[model samples]
Target: MSDTGGLFDGVLAAGPVAESVCDGAWVQAMLDFEAALAWASAAAGVIPEAAAVDIEKRCRAEYYDIAALGAAAVRIGNPAGPLVRELTASVAPEAAAYVHLGATSQDVLDTAAMLVTARALIALRAGLHACADRLAQLAEEHAGTVQAGRSLLQQAPPVTFGLTVAGWLGGVVAALDRIDVLRGERLAVQFGGAVGTLAALGDNGIPVLRGIAFRLGLAEPVLPWHTERSRIAEIAGALGQASGAVAKIARDITLLAQTELGEVFEQGPPGSGGSSTMPHKRNPVAAVLAAGSAAQAPGLVATLLSAAAHEHQRAAGSWHAEWRPLTELLRSTGSAVEWLCIALDRLRVDPARMRANLEASGGLLLAEQVAIGLVAAAQGAVGRQEATDLVAACCLRAGPDDLAELLAADEVIGKYLDRSRIDELLDPTGYLGSTAAFIQRAVQDWRSRSAGYR
Candidate 1:
């Protein structure tokens, strides 16, 4: 019946977003816990060597204040207040003196959240890089792998599987780049007291604040951020963007794997699906989940944007609403990354299917190639319009059988090229331009940049 109990209950039942935030609690806890240790160690010197050791042990100890912490959070409409009260209470009175010393509620909360965000970002960056690498590998492995490239749910032209993979890789690489940039940007901390000043800590405020940041592995900001919510918004936005990228890839995969277009399929044993009536159906469950999670990211980002509109010094509504939703976005995004990685890793590529599909449209897909050939043969004798007209006429008049016969018999074309040569040019495999080369470039670039972290 208590407010905290209700809060805990709500958080417990939350979807992926809540789970991410919940799992992230440990990282946040570690930051705050260390802050207390540093503060205690710096102040009163009341924290002895043995007690320091004890504090470390106790801080490392696994404990949950879900109910109490949740209740406190509701009372103050924020987690920081409840978290400080509970943690301070848990420490021995001697060690407790150092707990939260010279630091306001926002100090521990924001920095701790940043620590968690940093870790999450690191993990996410790695996941995106991995996805990019997988895509590159797939592109490399199937560089000349031909398939029908579809547009508007209909076959359009001959395209290599490598080219398709490369496109996906491009998106992943871009997302990775964004993540890298975000990591380097200074994530400001919330250090100010009740207002926007370090008045609580008096003259010792700056030093003590720096000490807390140093001990907790966080960046020190010039001032407290009771009102400036940009960093938080930026972090949320980054996460949302990354999730959206992953979702787009998932959506593409799901579409490509549709039974009607079966050019590719999920690699593993099909996970369970709906009704007993549709016994043969094996849905694209992982892809769907990834896509759905991705679809939710934009809304989360919007919420973060809304949160950024805090009133001059503080705005409770905008700030408080950010905690849970942002947490959920982080969690869902992480899950989506994990799922996408698995899906990409085990993807089933069908070069033959690609080839067959490409060929299904007859040699019409090679209309462009024919036009080029005509232009070359004409040697400026015919304009582009004339060449295109000739090629179009040839394509429409010739079926697969006829096209093969004509290519063999026509002196102007056949004398210069053979059946195999024409097939090679018309084939998606040979026409993939620089797909393989691009994949290699991406792989090298990503590996070089991600070397330290990987």
Candidate 2:
């Protein structure tokens, strides 16, 4: 990313997750597994405590040459073999014998992935909760603030801005809940020896697995899942869904902030989002970055899905296929969360503009309201379609003072309603039915769910 010369460094990739899944972080995670394994073996009485301490002292990632290890991995096919080989050489012969005694390369690698994933999820949770908080606040503040609802890109009827933000908050809350579940249930230690059977440890294998889980703060699995890949697939799907949720907010904000409908504004510094040539352009740069991350998500998730087709006990190529793609997919989701948080936290709302735009349609949106009001007043005199067409036809002609005035001057429907009732029918603010109640429900639901999560 540094070599790319600040492509999305600050915009998308500047979140808490960027550091947790870096190359350096991967190296450290793998090294931590080797040390944790030694600790687990000692606790299980499979290896002497003194030898475990000796091996642990030298299991630091810094002791290994990073570049040389990467280059050596090209011939061996993975960095794990070279890393283990170097770790073995770094320890005394007595200690080296027990360094990776009961484990295989996949155990170290899979557990390392879980470690990185756990830390990154913590960051993701924080970012997601922050976004939810912002939306919750907006929902509460704008509960009664009226705006025009649109369908197929055209104005339809009246709605509260709060309800729209509530929808976005609900999606983020759902995603957060599912990701937390996956973290709790699927984040188990991977410790199957050689071919999914702990042949090296014999009867001590299960005990060693429990020991590793306790030491690493992970969960113990029912069995070693070297070949079963549902855990990884489920997590990838959750992240993919989360990315979609993030993109929804971005898409809505970008759409609302268009020149013709200046309902919101993107957040950035003065010089940020400025066009290269246009002097007055302030583009929705945050949304652009989030959209880019989402655009990459489906393909990255596909790679993980395709890689699930692993062979027999261990996959040859398919197992290798997961490394780069899974990391990239997680990175893309991380970036989306990070950028969406920034965009949401500092969002600029224009309630006045929203009101103005709703009324800009000149009561065309209030046709349904007027028609329904006429029916209630008419009893049996005004037919539904007749009232509907009466208001619809009024939309095409010049009005007296406003829509209500024009409706009152109508030939047939005017006999049913007086001026005060017409005013009620034409009020967009009054027509936002149950918007505040829905916002409160969404906000309360989020509070309840997130309280349990925390």
Candidate 3:
């Protein structure tokens, strides 16, 4: 049999981050069941008001034997089989028949999964927004906090910690916007019985489906999606892309916090990652977890792509293969978002180290600035190539201290600008064009969009 362990397990092991996704699945399943019952009762006109009230009460208070559920699941080689049995046992005998009327196992399971995905996406958006907020705060706090910008593992030039944080915030904001776009798409449901057509439910099937969706707070689809799994595939793809953003941030943080760099550090207690042999090591464990979880999402997404290839109206094997992997993707992605949020919140930056690193580059970092200044001063007198050559020759020949002294003494260059003005222009803080402003705009936009729901 295929691996059918609960997606909750992977998320729980990571942290409370997966709680929203895990609990949402069970809650969504119950809600779908309620919606189906209510719709069926209204259409049949045989369901009494009192019976509907009792069914609602029982549905909300109902408990399941999870161990038995698991055993049954293994026996039948299906997750919905056990869930259906458990839900059936929870209601009164008279109302039990109407509980899942005209619904196949896929109807309940697929709808429930979509609900879980929606809730998870909401939680992930919140996580990304919170991280963006914190990053903006850090950027503001360290706007003038200059440090060495590295390329190819070598110090290059001066850059502010604020600017780096702003870059991260930009990526996160983009991901959040993508999530908002996806939330509006219709969450397709599987309602067709035995095949793509609703033969089992007779003529009134389409109307019943609309009623069911209305009751469940879902959009109605034109037809059942027994074979059309593109929506699911798309959601998984979006999730993987979001996870990639988190991973990129984690990788950058991990590199920045390296001992040799010493420009930034993780702010949590040092005991998070214990060394088996070495006593002085305090590893960036959260970063490592985020990277690993983010790395796994793409493969899970690929699995979804494979599952989308159904044979005719239904391929039980291919369809079932989607269940566990999709859940795992949700859980892992949720965990990555949570971890990155916390990591960004507690990060510590050292401006002094940044300056030292910049100086270590032997004045090479300011080559571009110097070239620009020369170009401006010469205007039509010097060509771009001559300006670059002059700056490069100056940078290559001068030591860290000698470069500063030489630049200060140069009469032609100093005539157009003083040392103070040059330093200010080259400062990383002055170079951050509109990072904080962009972050504020994103936050406001998100708030306006979410106002109605809140």
Per-residue lDDT of model 3, residues 1-454, tens digit only: 5565455455333645476555445544655656565555566564555556656665541365555665677776765676666666766787667666566677767777776777777777777777777776776777667766667877666666766766776677677766766776666455666675767567767776776676665667788887788878878878888888889889988998788877777767757755789888766767767787788898899999988987887676888898878878888887888878767766777778877776676566777777677777777676678777766666677775666555656665566657776666455455444645654554455456544322
lDDT of each: 0.66, 0.85, 0.69
Candidate 2 regions off by >4 Å? 1-8, 380-390, 396-406, 409-412, 449-454
Cα RMSD of all models vs. native, in order, equals: 4.8, 2.4, 4.4
Candidate 2 residues 130-223, lDDT tens each? 8898899999898887889999999988998899999999989989988988898898888998998899998989988898888888889999
Model 1 regions more than 4 Å off: 1-20, 23-64, 92-98, 152-154, 270-276, 393-425
Ranking by lDDT: 2, 3, 1
What is residue 247's positional error in candidate 2, in angstroms?
Answer: 0.6
Candidate achieving higher lDDT, 1 or 2: 2
Estimated TM-score per prediction? 0.82, 0.93, 0.83
TM-score of candidate 1 to 2 decimals: 0.82
Q: Say which candidate scores most in lDDT.
A: 2
C-alpha-based local distance difference test score of model 2: 0.85
Candidate achieving the largest TM-score = 2
Q: Give the CA lDDT, 0 to 100, for residue 280 in model 1.
A: 73
